[model samples]
Target: MRARLGGLPTFVLLVGAAYCLFPVAWVVVAATKSTGELFSTTTLSVGTSLLANLGELGSYRDGVFWRWMANSALYAGLGALLSAALSGVTGYALAKYSFRGRALIFNGLLAGVLVPAVVLAIPQYLLLSKVGLTDTYLSVLVPGVISPYGIYLARVYAAASVPEDVVEAARTDGASELRILTSVALPMMVPGLVTVFLFQFVSIWNNFMLPYIMLGDDGKFPVTLGLYTMLKQGNTTPALYTLVVTGALVSVLPLIALFLTLQRYWRIDLLSGAVKA
Candidate 1:
């Protein structure tokens, strides 16, 4: 009887999956088409010009497309790593320690999470400009290193996942606080930190406004802004449409690779700090 009733839920899930994936499937198919075929062919039909499109994208603007990719990787990768590290240490402190101003600081960081990024970005740009830092890589990177949500997640995970008794035992064995955090607490927090990293990584990768407002050099533009400029230019130069489409298809691969690589950490039980057996 349960098996007989599973069809409706299965149908609903398949419908949801298709709704999410249809655009991706269209992009995969559309990127393969030539300029003429792109407008001429059915949305789902495969075309023969994938390599040609890729070649054109590579040659565009003195191969600046690849430069955009590298900048994105640098910004997102470095920013996420730093954000995760800072969040881990900060979260661990908030979770494990009791000290003066601790609650006040944690509450302030929580309030920061409620404020939208757009609200803060303009002020950040203006302040950085006053110091002569705008338009540089540091302008983008420095702002991304602090994630209130990451800190919040880190705090929650540390409180719930990290064993207090294990920390006490390490201290009793003459381990320094720094050593205990690095060697013991961090390992226990891996699954949660991976979550923080992915969140920050995707947030930084897809971030457009901060870089758009901060950096003037095309050399420093990440893929999001790069593709936006391409699409904007496509209105005058219709050929750029193909490059944008192809670039969109290529850009998603890194995120997919990241998800696949870090997915195993999610399977580890946060409470038990072990893989389900």
Candidate 2:
């Protein structure tokens, strides 16, 4: 009975993996095909036109696809970095300090987390429009900077990972609050901060609606919106289908590389014997 139960869990995991990976597998195969082969051949068959498709994609609209890619990298990288910093500071303050209205603020953040981002898009747009910031890079980037979920995670992780004893010891050493945070608390918080960075990066990278509403210039569109525009165009120009598939495949490579690079940070146990003599 034990062996059967163990096998069942393994079997379920295998199925789940396949379910997630199958579309990725199809996209890989689809990207390699030429426009004609894409529809004429079987869904999973590999084709010989990958290089041709890549060349066309590069030359299309004077290489706007690459621009879209650069925009995505900028938005995700910068937005996540700023969000992580803000969340770390805010979360650490909430975790370590006893202050007025802290509970009220944290509770408000919890409520923010419960609210769907989609619901805020219109209101955010209206607010930015009043300031004449809409249709600019700041429009998309600013909204993502204050992530309620990221703040919440940072708070939980700071409470668990950073010890009060270490903080008090730093105070005894006459370290300024900023110095203590920079030198002591932030180091131990690296793993959790990394998680926050990765989460916000992925969220901003994959986000569509906010950008769709905020950005009017095609030049400022991220990869997600760029590919979406191509998909829309594909309805009339069928040949763009191959390019869309290829773009989808290429778009995922950076995310995979990022995860592989950051996975090592997750294993660091900075809290282990952190206060040892």
Candidate 3:
């Protein structure tokens, strides 16, 4: 009876999956088409021009596409790792210690989550400019490093995962607060930290607007912004559409590969560190 009842939900889910997969399927198919065939042929029909498209994209703007990819990886990889560690530290401190203005700080960070990225971006851009940091990597990265949502998640995980008794025990053992945090608390926050890392990684990788505003040089563009610029130029030169499509396909591959490779850590049972084998 349960299986039978699940059929409708499963059917609905499959429909949603198909809706999501359609565009990816279309991109894979469309990227293989020549400029003329892109619109001439049935939208999903595969063509023989995939190799040509890949080559064109590889050759575009003196191989600037690849440079954009590298910049994105650097930004996302370094930024996310740093954000995760910071989140872990902030979370641990908030969870373990109850002190003056604790509630105020926690509430402020929580309130930050409600603020849209766009709302603060311009102000951040202005402030970074004032500090002589604009149009550099730091301009884009600095604002992103302070992820309120990450801190919130980290706080929740730290509170639930690291027991106060264990913390007190560490303290009683004459463990310095920093030492206790580094060795004792951080190890326990592994699962949650991994979640934060992946979240920030995807967010940074997919970000368009911040990098768009901060970086003046095409050399500094992330894959999203780079691809968008390519697609925009494709308006005047139809042949470039193939390159843009191919670039999009290539860009998603790394994200897919990364997720597939380390996805075990993403099981993310924050409430319990134990993962099913």
- The C-alpha RMSD in Å for every predicted model, in order, reads 3.5, 3.8, 3.6
**Residue lDDT tens for model 3, 1-277:** 8869889989999999999989889888988998888879988778989998888888887899999999889899899999999999998888778799988998898899888777777887788888888788777776667788788778878877888899889999999999999999999999889989988998999988898777777888889999898889888988888888888889998888888888886754443321210
**Ranking of all candidate structures by their lDDT, best first:** 1, 2, 3
Off by over 4 Å in 2: 264-277
Candidate 2, 17-55: lDDT as tens digits: 999999989998898999999999998889999899989
The best candidate in terms of lDDT: 1
Clashing residue pair totals per candidate (backbone < 3 A): 0, 0, 0
- Candidate 1 weakest lDDT stretch, 10 residues: 268-277
Q: What TM value does model 2 have?
A: 0.92
TM-score of each: 0.93, 0.92, 0.92
Write down the lDDT of every candidate, Cα atoms only.
0.90, 0.89, 0.84
- The collision pairs in model 2 are none
Better of 2 and 3 by TM-score: 2
What pairs collide in candidate 1?
A: none
Query: Could you give candidate 1's per-residue lDDT for residues 1-277 as a string of tens digits?
Result: 8987889989999999999989989999999999999998888999999999999999988999999999999999999999999999999998889899998998899899888777888999899889999999999998899998888778878887888899999999999999999999998998899999998999999999999889899999999999999999999988889889999999998998888888875543334321210
- The CA root-mean-square deviation of candidate 2, after full C-alpha superposition on the true structure, stands at 3.8
